[model samples]
Target: MDTVIRMNRRQILTGLASGSVVAFAPGCVENPTLGRSQLILVSEEQIAQLSAQAWQQSLQRERVSRDPALNAQLQRVGRRIAQASGLGYDWEFVVFDSDQENAWVLPGGKVAFYRGIMETMENDDQVATVMGHEAAHLAGRHAAERASQQQAAGIGLGLAAVALDAGDVENTAQWAAILGAGVTFGVLLPYSRRHELEADRFGVDYMVRAGYDPREALDFWTSKAAQRTGRPSVPEFASTHPSDETRIAALREYLVARNYI
Candidate 1:
């Protein structure tokens, strides 16, 4: 009698490693109906788990803003944009009491906005642009994409060794704090340049669909880059985001070529 354990696709390609497994490099998922994206590997269930945990920490650990009307405004704006998304996932909006100008959307329509960014917009359109960008990220499954990349990285590392054992990566701490995602935005993620650009482009259109002018997205990014003033932001190499200047330029090129302005 032979006891043969069948390895899943991920285990097969990844061969064997220490504490890990990987699947074959899959092709990009394309949604022709909506021209959006869908998950090809990592399940939405996993995203929900990650999102739930991260959101709990955000509410408990992060400072929350107290302005009543501001929170209301965020909800209103987020709703309008989310409606345009046509995504049927669970949605949420949260305002954090912070001075840094940042906003992000997690998978499953879990959205958050920092009050600091509220100060940057001159009108609803600008804010809408930002919202659209964040929305684009979720709609395109950017978080899952990042997660997939991280899986690949971990699998690659595992495959480098012998058959995977759970203890191989037990003690190694990552060093992507400067900009990479081991701890921050791309936690356990390693994205390529292509994904970021796609997100940016898709964001512009989402803004348009949400009835906001897409051109301002370009302006918004340019203004942000200009305001950097040599301040240390996370480096692009390790960060999931592109450089400020690069992002601004890409937005410009995208807007001009598409006549979205």
Candidate 2:
């Protein structure tokens, strides 16, 4: 529901249903959640369901390596970051048996890392940088925000996005369920670019609080972006984060200001 229409400036919308067409506002459409149909269509439960389904599908299709060593390292980093956010622990870190270089942290402290990305991290600090960024997305509640924005923009829940499965997803994820191996690799891995950058910002702060060198975070992302640049990440609208350069530049500025560099 719209509290007010503020395309440029905030204006009070009195009542359109009252038929009192003589109010102060001439060029405004009055929208209210109390009486009007909820234009913000999706519920928190729906978003959660959708994301959870998608994530669930994702984990099952991929080969998950239940490697104790890798899981511990990832959890260590993820927890360090999450703990700083004042969110309690019950963190689950799973390493996927895949070549794709990506990682994700679901809401409610679920974290995952691909074998390829973990191998690329030269040290725990570097891995911590990546983990911090991913955790930031959940810590900052970026996914829920993205879903809200998507609903507001009239983009319905993604076809393969997180929603309750009418039937059943085989294995991997209980949420963020990607349906097929092909789609998981090609489609679901990326997030909206805005979500990506916001994660970066959140990640930077987490890495610092976790006692990792924040300056290296940029290089960390740069390395990942460079690897996938020629392939071109999914288009912006479909993606959850910004392109690599934009993310790098923003972080560069913020980190420099924060003296994390």
Q: Where does candidate 2 stray beyond 4 Å?
A: 1-43, 51-55, 159-191, 228-240
**lDDT digits (tens) for residues 1-261 of candidate 2:** 010011111110111112233333222122321122212233434444444444565566667887787777887776777787666746777788766566666556666677767888877788877777667666545545444444444443343232211111011232223234344334433434444566677778888888888867877777777776666344543333455677789889989888887
Task: Please list the C-alpha lDDT of all candidates, in the order they appear.
Answer: 0.58, 0.55
Cα lDDT tens digits, model 1, 143-261, are 56655555554532111111111111011112242223443444432343445566678777777887888867777777777777676666666544567777678888888898886
Question: Candidate 2 at residue 236, lDDT?
Answer: 40
The all-Cα superposition gives candidate 1 an RMSD in Å to the true structure of 10.7
| lDDT of residue 250 for candidate 2 | 89
My TM-score estimates for the predictions, one after another, are 0.71, 0.65
Clash count list over all predictions:
14, 34
